[model samples]
Target: MTAIAIDHDKPDLTGDTETQNDIFLQVFNSGDGALFDRLYRDDAISNFSGEPLTGEARRKFFVEFIGAKPVLEARVTHSYVAGDVALIGVDFSVKGTGPDGQPFTIEGKCTDVLRRVEDGRWLMAVDRPVAAGGLLPE
Candidate 1:
């Protein structure tokens, strides 16, 4: 288990997972789903619970998600690398307005998997957020 302390005042968007996490926060808060083009791979999958989402389904989800424009704060608990694939655990909290314009907040952990591409860049491959536990896949 590794602990990461993120300084909200000065977030450095230079590294791998850290940069993406910040991007995640930014896109959500700003309701800019277009930014997803840079943060995720074309075949990327995201799971809130159960099986991951991909393809057109994923795109539609992002549209709905961005419309909510949730504010988020995520902290990395642990990260592991193996060749091109990396598994990262993040603890996160989110607050936002609902369809009714009521503010709400939720806190939990997420497991995000990233892969290093041939271009020497890292992109999210799988994202499982707000799960009950920060458990990594076997």
Candidate 2:
């Protein structure tokens, strides 16, 4: 099966984290990890599972994450942009089947750091999943 490839600026938000996050939801719901691969830089880091993800590992994790076919929605609660960098706080809900085919849904918050490219496109630089007050334990 061929996965869909989402544009990096699909939603095309003008430095708006809320709409960008909504676009993330749309990309996630599309069940396409390709979009994630494109949204993150080669050196981008994510701590969604406590451990850091970078280089090929980040891509691996995203492949597995998206491969799970999760249905997710995100609402940005806070956003700050200065120059070429931005920080966003989001509350999100995700429902999906586990590896054992068990159904699961997680509602949590996250903090994401994004950087604007030379062409004025935003991509994730650091994405840390926030739950239970702070970063997910390692």
Candidate 3:
């Protein structure tokens, strides 16, 4: 079966990380990994598992992560922009059923670094979600 793509009519990724946050949530909830990946750079890093993951590892992780059919909620806590770069802080939660058929929920805050490419589109360079105490194993 073929799937049809929908145009959300949202603005293109620009200098507004605030609006991008909303777009991120929408794409995430849609569970379209290919579309979701467009929000990040080719070499982007995601610390979702408490370890920095990039390259094919990151793509594989995201594929599994999205396969859980997780639902996400994110709120932009703070954002700062300088030149072609931006840093955004977000509080978020995700709930879904694991591959083992167990229900799981994760709530945390994330720090994201974004950069505007030559085409004037902002993409995440780093995405690191931290626990409440801001601690991760060394």
lDDT of each prediction vs. the true structure?
0.67, 0.74, 0.76
Estimate, for each residue in 1-138, the C-alpha lDDT of model 3 and write its tens digit. Answer: 122343443224567766777777777777766666666788988787668888788777777787567998888999999999899999998888988989988888889999988777788889888866443452
**Positional deviation of 57 in candidate 1, in angstroms?**
1.5
Question: In lDDT terms, which candidate is top?
Answer: 3
Residue-wise C-alpha lDDT for candidate 2, range 37-102, written one tens digit per residue: 667766888886568888888777778888788988777889999998899999877788988989
For model 2, the superposed segments whose C-alpha errors exceed 4 Å read 1-14, 132-135
Top TM-score hit: 3
Which scores greater on lDDT, model 1 or model 3? 3
TM-scores of all predicted structures: 0.74, 0.83, 0.84
What lDDT is reached at residue 22 by model 3? 73
lDDT of 1 at 92: 88
For candidate 3, the TM-score is 0.84
* Candidate 1 lDDT over residue span 93-125, tens digit each: 877787898886767788888887766667778
What C-alpha lDDT, on a 0 to 100 scale, does residue 14 get in candidate 2?
A: 38
Clashing pairs in 1: none
